[model samples]
Every structure is written in C-alpha cells, then in structure tokens.
Target: MIDLNQSDKRQLLFDAARELFLEQGFKKTNVAAITERANVAVGTFYKYFASKEQIFYEVYQAENEKAKRKIVARIDADQSPKEVVKQFLQEIIRTSEQNAILAEWYRNTEASQVLMNYNQECDVQKNSFVYRFLLDNIERWRSSGQFRRDIDANTILALFNVLVLLDNHKEEIGHEHFPQVLELLAEMIIDGLTASS
Candidate 1:
C-alpha cells in the first residue's frame, strides 16, 4: 500500500527537517523553513508530519537508532556484565555527542521530553536495542551466577534507568563534572551488581 512518490516526498521533507534541526536547532526551526528547504508546498508538510516536534522526534530517532546498532555491534561477546554496562555507558555518551540532534535529547526541551517518552515506551515493552541488549546480558550473567541472584532483573533495569533520570537533572546535580559523576555512578552500580562475582 505504499505510494513510492509520496514516500519520496516524505523522505525529502525528513531530510530537510533533519538538516535544519542540526543547523538551526529545534527552537529556531519551523515548519515553513522545513517545507521551503524540502522544496515542497507548506501543505505537503502536514501530509507527512503533524508538526515540527513530530519531525524533530523522527530526526532524533534516526540518530538514536544508528547509535543503538553501533552500541550493540561494539559489544564484546566475552565481556562480563560489568564491563558490558560500563562500555555501553561510555559509548552512549560518545554517540550522543557525535549526533547533534541526539545530544539535544539530553537537554531540557520539548524535543527531549518526546525522546524520553520514546524511551519510556520502549522500556515498558522491553524491546529497545539498549534495553534488550542489557536485559539479555543481565539474564545471562544471572544464570551463570556472575550477577547477584538476590537482585531481580527489573531492579537492575531500574538501576540503569537512573542514568536517564540523572541526565534530566544535570543542572540540579551540577553540570560542571556531570560526566565524571556519571562515570563514578556507573562504577558504583556495576561494582555493586557484580559484587557477588
């Protein structure tokens, strides 16, 4: 049921929107700017996207999807859960920094909220790349008696979810050394999780 021509137009709009978002950023970019950049009628944008926020979310998602795959591919099959989680935390920061729109998701903005909502949805389903990647790793470790059997997977999942919550509170937590803080926090959590081993 896919219309090739319409799909092409939609992609044009999306490509244009992503460029504008990366260049001017979310606050400065508008629908008309996107449509003009895409070389399409303003009305055409409506047919493809509900609003600028929707397109921004899609743009951000594209970046995140790439990051997710990259993170998974970077995983070492022989690594322990602690190392896996540690490397994942580091790689996620690196990838986020590499993508301007993805980095924007860490900021306090409407777009960030949308991105968080996307994460929350994926969390509930337990199907997101990172969630599934970590979940499977945790379960494997738990079964191998490497991770603490006393601690359920959901509790550990909640523990990792703290990272996202902390990102939202960097200003309150002091942004001066937030990266160090995150590194320290990850070490503490990973050590605690692997204390049994």
Candidate 2:
C-alpha cells in the first residue's frame, strides 16, 4: 500500500528541511541546502515538491499527524471525559513546546496560510475528528444529567479554538498556571454545557 521509494525520499526531504528550518529558518534556508542535506539531487527534490513552500507544507503535515497521534495516545488511557480533556490540552501545549520550530513558525511566518491551503486541499474531515470524539464520549454524561442536552457537539470544537488561543499565550499566563488556566476554561465550557446544580 505504501510506495517505499517515494515515501523514503519524501521523508528524507522532510527531515532535512525540518532540521534546516529549525536551525536557520525557512526564509534563510534555500532549496540547495535542503537537497544537499537530504543527499538528493535538486531535481529529485523538485520531483516530490514544487517549491520550498511545498516541502515545508509536507513537514508541517507530518507534524500535525504526530500531534494527532500524541493526542490520541494521551486520551486513550482510562480517564473521565473531563480528565481526558485536561490531558488533551496539556498534550497540545507540551507538543508545541517540544516543537520549537512550530512555535517559531507560527510567530515569525505567515505559515498558517500555507497550512490552511493544505488543509483545504487534503483534510476533508477537518476539525470534525476532535469534535466528534468529544461529543460521543460526553453523550453518556448528558444522558445521566451531568451535561446539558442543548449543547451541540460542535460547541466542543469551538472550545478547542479557545484552548489554542490560551496555549499560544503561554508567557502571559506562564507555564506554572497552565493547569489552572486549562481547568478554568474547561470548567467554563462544562458549566455552559451542564445544567446548574
């Protein structure tokens, strides 16, 4: 099912590009550097990607896939929906911190434009996976009168957007306050979706 040669070459480019991007940055790193680092001919690089932007796009895609995998693994452990949600936020924050290139990319580059375009072209499911996962798992709570029946599953997706904003403001809140901040936001969301006791 997998094209070994194509996959290996693509990964070679991605790994090399990611290293260079991390070291010198996107604007500073040229295709020649990437090709040399990848031990591939310049033509070989072009065979897999149209431009440096395209290569970075693949790199970011792989990063997102890794993030999703981490999220899935962190959530799969036995935990309450609320606990899982907390860990999910923690995982994202941890991942972003671990991937300094991602933070730097978000801060210095209008890289979101390329990322958005890539998502539009490839991710038909978009943000639905996260939203649906939360909604399905939380439904039992709703049935047990622990959550509000009126809250839409999409509301959880919207909450994810807020979490992103909060995570991005790590300095303002500081890492020491992350758990409280996340819990507060989660509580606010839960309150909005649950009947008042």
Candidate 3:
C-alpha cells in the first residue's frame, strides 16, 4: 500500500527541511516553510508527515547514522588504539563542523529529547560501528602488550566518550590551552595504563 513515489517525495521534504532547519534553526522553522522549501504543497507535506517535528526526527536520525558511518570508515585497523582514537576524535569534530545539518541539529535542535526516545537497541549496529571499532582496538592493544593490562576496556570506552565530547568544545577550550589539556589528559591516561614504561 506504500507508494514509492510518495516515499521519495517525503524524503525530499526531509532533505529540504534539514537544510532550512540548519539555516533558520528549529524553533523558527515551521511546516509551511518546510513545504515551501521542499517545493511541495502543504497538503503534500501533511500526507507524509503531520508536523515538522517528525521530519526533523527523520533528518536527525539519518544525519547521525551517516556521520557515524563516515567516522568509522576513517579509522585504520593498522593503527594503534591511541592513534585510532585520535583519528576518530578528529574525524568526528571535522565532519560535524563541515556538515551544517549535523552541526545545527546538535546545537539548535531538541537532540536530547530525540535521543531519549531513540531506541538504542534498534540503532546499535548503525551507532556502534565506531564504538565497537574503538573498543576492539583498545582490547587488541592491551592484549598485544602495547598498552597496559590494567586499563579495562570499559575505562577506555569512557575516556574515549569524554574525549569526543570535549573535542566538540575545542573552540571554547581555546587553541593555546586545548593542546596542553589534551597532552596532560593523554599522558595521565597512558601512564596509568602502561606497565613499567
């Protein structure tokens, strides 16, 4: 009963709405604006989604999934865990800034509310690609005697998450202080994990 053409039209709306949302911000965006931006009729918009919130959710979900995939693809298996983590952190920060939709979604949208309702189990594979890569590499490095055995995988995961969150505020961290903070943080973590080194 689902019409392919209708589905495509809906996606078109989502795409246009995302761009507009990034430019105008969510609180300022509305259903009429989305339809006009999509070059579709208001009735056409209602046929696909009842409101802008639903379209926003779709757009956010798609962007988040794409960003996660791109970040994971940037990781190299040959790299050490520390290097891999650094690459991931850099990629995420760079990609998020470059992708206007993603930047706006995180900065201006109700991301916390959407994330609360998002099904982690359903999104596990799409969302965890980078996480699994990071965790697996951490374990590999530890087993290979490259990193200290005392550093548990869970601890590494926590640190990686914290680093990624911190990287998002790099501008606030300031160019002069960011490197010093990162170096100090990395040294403390590595020293705690390293064996006799």
Highest-lDDT candidate = 1
TM per candidate: 0.86, 0.69, 0.66
Candidate 1's C-alpha lDDT? 0.80
The C-alpha lDDT values of all candidates are 0.80, 0.70, 0.69
Candidate 2 scores a C-alpha RMSD against the true structure in Å of 4.7
Instruction: Encode model 1's per-residue lDDT on 45-76: one tens digit a residue.
Output: 99989888778878887778778888889789
| Model 3: how far residue 20 lies from native, Å | 2.3
Which parts of model 2 have CA positions greater than 4 angstroms off? 1-5, 76-80, 120-132, 158-184
Which ten-residue region of model 2 has the weakest summed lDDT?
Answer: 103-112
Residue range 49-108, candidate 3, lDDT tens digits: 867766776776688777888778767868755566556656765686677666653454
Candidate 1 Cα outliers beyond 4 Å, as residue runs: 1-4, 107-110, 117-125
List all candidate RMSDs to the true structure.
Answer: 3.1, 4.7, 4.8
Model 3 bad stretches (over 4 Å): 1-6, 22-28, 39-54, 105-126, 164-191, 195-197
- Give the per-residue lDDT digits (tens) of candidate 2, residues 1-197: 53459889987888999999778766788899998998888998888889988887777666766676768766863565567777776676667666845654345435655655665687535554555566566766666766666765566556656865564565568667876787789867866766554
